[model samples]
Target chain A: MSVPFYDSGVASGLLSGILFGYVLEAAGFGSARKLTGQFSLKDWSVFKVMFTAVLVAAVGLYLLRLGGMIAGNSVYIPTLYLWAMAAGGLLIGAGFAMGGYCPGTSLVGIVSGRVDAVVFVVGMIVGTMAFAGVYEPIQGFYFAAKGPDAQRLPDLLGLPEWLILAVLIVVAIAGFVLGSRLERARGGPFTAEDVNGEDTSKAKNQNTTFNTEAGIVP
Target chain B: MTSSPRPFWPPLVAGAALGIALLISFLITGHGLGASGFVTRLSAQISGWLAPDLTTANAYFGPFLTAGAPLASWITWEVIGVLIGGYVGARTAGRSRLMVERGPQASVGQRFAFAFIGGALVGIGGRLARGCTSGLGLSGGATLAVAGFVFLAGFFIAGFVVSALVRRAWQ
Candidate 1:
């Protein structure tokens, strides 16, 4: 396929990035407290946002391809380097749990003026260089960490991708239901404003709100 | 006499917005979303800048030298937009507080220290795994990639484990 505008990905990427950032910030993902809420199960916002996005994209893309709206990228399914992916994900999760941001989300935090997010980004950059420098020393485990295949699970299982997507959507909806009930049980009777952590008056009115100064309604 | 701005959107709603953005991305370009690749490219460029011969000669940086302008990637630009968009989103939501996000128990210096270490882990992990949350979790996951689920499973399991150890960071 002919590349779109050859090298003007600047425009495409910039506009998309802008939208991506705007939505992330709107979700309150820029806040570490809000994000970490998932780890503690204090707030299900992170899980809610993430799974919802996954469901939408998975279902939407599958349908789009079916309808032939988007022919789709050739390597739609990423290669499953099982061990590397597992190890890397674990480490990144540790980072996310501790730093409260991923590379993409950290950008949102930095733009929103979180000092720690900035520090995290800096550290990631340095770490990338360090990893590159050490790449040669550990090629065996890193390079050879392959999964059974690089295709989507549906492809491997001989089912339609949309079917799995449907299954995922069902699971996500169930999760959403469970998350809501849990939230109510954890902190009863929260208004939209309190959940958003935007009401200054509410914070002022209550000495011991559910949330701390960071906005994870304690 | 004004309505309160929602501190954030409903996750479903916000996720819908994200879904649409991702759809547009696939429509226009045959790519999903990513963030760590930009950092890798930037690192290569920096290495090139610092030691022109090193970038040209090193194993990791050498391939980048042949791959045209690494700095002008879509992901790099997207991240730049992330910064701008994040600022706008935070301000719009009335949640743009410029401070370190740490638990009451953790000090500023300690929080920043952890932030750096955690970030470094992410960097190495992204490289080792060839993607990050946005890249692997969302982009690849959306495609029903098996690796996506693996990353997801690994991410949560390890995240929970580590959180147990460093519970003080964000108590």
Candidate 2:
């Protein structure tokens, strides 16, 4: 009883990435301004899309595993490296605030024809090289924690996966419910330019002209 | 351009679809989804190609070179597809436009600098954590991985904390 074809490694990576990319674009993450706005009290599309995707996947995986459809242990989980992951997370987060795009969003941004996104991609490559050059010094801390590799939240908390997942779903629902309102309060429906405090009438005009030219009814 | 906020897939629907896709990945590959691993592998390969002796000498690069997929991996292929799919989705949705997006107050040059710096940080961070948002936050969270939880917690805190300092960039 194997699960499905699209679930495997390389194949699923391709499928999931494509789907994820589509989802990201649909959420308007290709626009750096839209993404950065999540940090602002302005718009929260990033939170909305990200949490939605996470909760949906969390519940889905929980149910499938509970149903005996897939072996939970078979799922790939990285070995725990506390210091490395923490430091990396902080660095990456700082980068997010500065750059406004994750690896995933940068790809989508580049696809959507954003020049900044392209520069971001090049930066990623350079960063990788920089890290590699200094890999020797960092490797020790990076591989420091060789804890029980069978680490999972449920296992760590000594709770059932189903129960933990259920709680997560509830939290996601609440967040979404609250987030929508917060977004509206911040700025109901402003363009990236507007949210950034730029004169957005030009963007509005461009939108109207494009819509009229393309015969799009909106 | 319609000025109307484009409709997004409902959160629940989008989540479920993403979940199913992740589930499918687990079922087929005996593992879940990932993004950073490819970058790590690529980085390793690039290092090896650039300086075989140095790559081989490093303990980190040793196992990956021997144990992992070849340079032309499925993950690499999938990333390529992600690029294509992203392009298609953006174009169809009228979201495809060539522009440097930044906070209105942020200069194009400043934003570009941040974009590069942020990207570099992500590259290193993903490798250090053994995953990125896609790998740790999404797939690992789905699978209930402890590392995933830790990574997510760390990332959110860092993002929010730094967000304040960079306020001028966004608005």
Identify the leading candidate in terms of DockQ.
Answer: 1
lDDT of 1 by residue, B29-120 (tens): 56677889888898889888888887788788788977888786678888887878877776665666656777778999999999999999
lDDT by residue (A1-218, candidate 2, tens digit) is 46644343465567766776776666666777777666664656666666666666667666767788866665567667889888877877777777888877788888888888888877776776677767778778978876578588777889987778778778877877787787777754344333222344665565644546423344
Q: What is the C-alpha RMSD of each candidate to the true structure, in Å?
A: 4.0, 4.2
For candidate 2, give the DockQ. Answer: 0.57
lDDT of 1 by residue, A6-86 (tens): 233788888878888999888878777777767776678777888888878777776766676555554346789878888
Q: Where does candidate 1 stray beyond 4 Å? A: A1-8, A72-75, A148-150, A188-218, B1-5, B66-68
Q: Please, what are the lDDT tens digits per residue for candidate 2 over residues B96-139?
A: 66677777688888988888888888887877777788777777
The DockQ scores of all candidates, in the order shown, are 0.64, 0.57
State interface RMSD in Å for all models.
2.5, 2.9
Off by over 4 Å in 2: A4-13, A188-218, B1-6, B10-12, B48-58, B61-70
